[model samples]
Target: MAIKFLFFPFTHMNKSQLKTVLAFFPACHYLSMNRDFKHDPSLQTLFETGKINPIFPLPEPLEKVEQNFGQYLAWARIHKGNKVNLKSLLKDSPYFTDDSDVTAITSQIKGEKSDKEDANADALTKEQSLLQDLLFLKMAHLCDEQNEGIDLALNDLIIGHDTLIASLRGCQSLVSHVKDKKTIARKDLGEMMPGQRIRAWARSLSAMGALEPQGGTPLFITTSEAVFGYLEASCKDLVNALDIHKIKVHENECENKNEWQHLFCTWLMRAVQGDGIRENDMPVVDDRCSLLGQVKLALFSGNGINKIFNCSDKQIPVCLIKLK
Candidate 1:
């Protein structure tokens, strides 16, 4: 199987390999539009006026995906100022591909006539998933920069809300934990559970809604699968305590003992009825109503032959909660 072009999490891919992969639609859009961007008088004016600023000659070898992606957004913002245009560029390639060409590419990749229909479906799913990952990474970059970032402000223009900025403030501590380690691990779990980090995130959502009412609950996205796994493991206890089978969505409807299970909501709900008493009369979460709950967990995947999300040493565990 020819898997070279797939680029899973992409930590190992060299510069030439990345350049080869990015020669396609979505990535190519910026590279084509911003050819010699320094020559553009309008963009140069924006730079002079303290409007658009992007790190050019992006960190030689360009190993980190965000370094290049940040540059892409910078070019797009300078050229396309409209929210509609920016969001479209963020989600899809401005240059359109015809159906015949797309079909041919899909057929070549899958290399089987009988699997043509399945291949098309799978390819679309993977493409959409990739776009989603990109979106999350961009947001994570904004969250990391917090007070110093303008990407979230630009995103507010696209999404029509400043909730992400406020929400970032609430989860800044948790974000820092991952940033310090560069991955998720058992210690991260310790910090999350004992500190009631999940509850804090839920409260952040609640505050966002109260401060600026919006259509839906904004998700607290993270690259920490360890955090997700901790919540997933608690699904059984939450199921028993809350007496809601639907709380944990199983892979199958039948009573399969070994079926994979995941939480419907990554937010932690108080399984018990009342707030715990405090020794020193500390503040407690008012749990009269359900807090708006949502979270998206992005994870890294590598072939069994390739080690991922961990160091070569067996004992000294390092953080692996990285953006793909």
Candidate 2:
């Protein structure tokens, strides 16, 4: 007798459909190691009390999820700026805005000039300190909400909610320190602990074509891509969906043709391999190949048009130039 197991790929299914399938695969359920302790108590209570519903709606639409996550990142950036800017503005208003009128007004005040200057300086310092405190509170609140959103997304995915919450909490602490003026060392975004399971879940969602990783540390994004590729290949439908576009190579006609051609060829080869394309099937075009040549020219010509040229729905003019 031989033991056997079945694996069903449900990459294309939306949240509701995925839940239905997971319901039948009870053995596959695994808790995220990074789960938030604060939220975990409530979640466990809900589960124990039979309040865990099988059909809870996802917090946002699939297309909007990545956008929502991007908004969180943007909020993080703005929050950091708000702390620094608010503090600086209070400490030295002239640094942020013109204060010629204030300077003249201060000079006109006659009595107790030295005392007034000291008092003003003290007041400004206090205001800056208060603003810094408020910014930290706002950052903490934003972090909490973001952590909750991550958990909700994980709950939908059926993985990594706990681990994600823990990571978010850690991130919040690090970011809070970064916002404080008294902090001696600058917080390195890249130095944060790598939550491998959360990364995997994010990549899994990306592989399902439900999300896209935007701006982040290069190492994080690279590791995420590796995990995403693995999970994506696990689904036959996703693999098929990805194969619709193929990366090909062609020689470049630049002044440094040899170097450019070599680099382009190597990059194209890697892309093809990464996409699971067979070596023999990789397309090769001539140096004068219209589409490839145009793409190369576009890259050199300007920014913002690199990938747009290759998009399936793109339209380009087919002007004819004749040599005399």
lDDT at 34 for candidate 2? 21
Query: For model 1, how big is the CA root-mean-square deviation?
Result: 21.7
Q: Estimate each model's TM-score.
A: 0.21, 0.18
What's model 1's lDDT at 203?
Answer: 26
Please list the residue runs of candidate 2 whose C-alpha ends up more than 4 Å from where it truly belongs after superposition. Answer: 1-22, 31-42, 46-324
**lDDT of candidates 1 onward, in order:** 0.29, 0.30
> Tens-digit lDDT track for model 1 on 1-324?
101111222111222222222221011111111223465565455446543332221232223334445544566467565887656654687342432232232332233343554566556653333332333333333333342234435533533333345456786655444433312111222222321333322222222232121332212223334555545443322212221111122111223312211111112211121233222232122333222222232222222111222212221111112212
In model 1, state the lDDT of residue 186. Answer: 16
lDDT of 2 by residue, 152-180 (tens): 56554433444456467777564544433
